[model samples]
Target: MEIDVEQYKKDLLAQGAEVVFSKTKNLTDTPFSYCGGCGHGVAHRLIMEVIEEMGITDKTIGVAPVGCAVIAYEFWNIDAVQAAHGRASAVATGIKRTNPEKFVFAYQGDGDLAAIGTAETVHTCNRGENIAIFFINNGIYGMTGGQMAPTSLIGMPSSTAPYGRNPDMHGYPLSLTNLLAQLPGTYYITRQAVNTAANVRKCKKAIRQAFENQKLKKGVSLVEIVTNCNSGWKMTARQANKWLEENMLSQYPLGDIKVPKTDN
Candidate 1:
């Protein structure tokens, strides 16, 4: 006999078991615009899920930069603002300062955050802005063609670096999360991935913690997610995940780089 998936889910719910999958109220019903196998959709869903779970969907605001996440305003049900290339952090800072009661976050990509937005990011963290910064580090400019970004691995190939990124020519990849961790203004800094089930759970927890830190009026909280850009990498979704596990994780290990010291 064929199992009734919906009936099984209903039976589980009747037994007081939580639903493992459901659409978050903070996210729109419209389909995602991201490429197939891209991690952006997953990240978006996770963030929205956290916000919904925290019951802050109505009071949270998101600032999206001019990268693949630029159109986030369309997907997120909460109020969202569009910032210029690499300016999401600055915009988020302003929003948080003006509306301290609201939860403000900036969602950005590697190219937008590590390249053109470097100064803004550093200064925002240095000034201790009470905001959450979600940095999606796919290592390439996924939106505007696959160009070499500041976080691209030494030998990763992009549209701009067809023969692989040369250290001599492109310089070494910027360890932005590590650099931010050293800044006194930052309260929490972590590097996470969404390529696996375990990592996805960890990533969701990290995002929730980051938002919780913001609620405490703490300094800047940065969650850098090392994701896969299958289209940009010129690899299938499965191949991209395998490559990310083998290559990207080594350069950007998953873990908390910094956290607040609790008083014993």
Candidate 2:
């Protein structure tokens, strides 16, 4: 049964059925290379949609480093540059400073941001650089053989901590987003997720607000997305999402941690 796709869209439009969901042009045609149930793809879509909606597709620059989202440049249609492992935030600092008029952001994973790039990430926000950062915290290191990461919750098992994460042995999970929110240079900070439909909408709103801060020239705006690493966790997509909701959210709760002060 052959069906005409364009004509099908036309028929739906003729019936007065508005298309509420469609791929934003800010994304490339490249299919996501993430695992079947990983949240990076959904997180990526939210960011690109925000860029498109803000009409900054051409004026935007994104920096992605190592980990699961290393090939992010291929997915986002806007101008982007790849940085060395754990150097995305540092590189983004340079890019934003040189092209101060352009909107810039860094897309990084847990290991890349909270672990190796800890110094750069903290310093970038400390300086209150006018840029947004999107951090995806999947708990474990997804791309590097599922090793333990700085954000891995206590008692979570990983390749490095097969017995389960122990604070005495592995150190407690570092709530990086909360730490950044305390920095005076940081203008906006929030933690959100894409595990469910309702959460996805809220996460999208957070992403949009992060980008808007750039226009306002506010300091650093960070949005931490608590996500899942299904393959790394040795669980099916469905099982991983369920586990994420049960465990991950408890350590990294969703909602705004900091916002610009209102002068009423």
Question: Best TM-score goes to which candidate?
Answer: 2
Per residue, candidate 2 scores C-alpha lDDT tens digits across 1-264 of: 999988999999999999998898988989999999999999999999999998988899999889989999999998999999889989999999999999999999999999999999999999999999999999999998899999988888999999999999989999988999889999999999999999999999989998889988879999999999999999999999999989998998888999889989
Predictions in order: lDDT: 0.93, 0.93
Q: Please provide TM-scores, in order, for all candidate models, with all chains considered together.
A: 0.92, 0.93
Query: What range of 10 consecutive residues in model 2 has the weakest lDDT sum?
Result: 209-218
Q: Give the backbone clash total of model 1.
A: 0
Pairs of colliding residues, candidate 1:
none
lDDT, candidate 2, at 63: 97
lDDT of 1: 0.93
Q: Give one digit per residue, the lDDT tens place, for model 1 in 96-203.
A: 999999999999999899999999999999999999999999999999888999999998999999999999998999988899998999999999999999999999
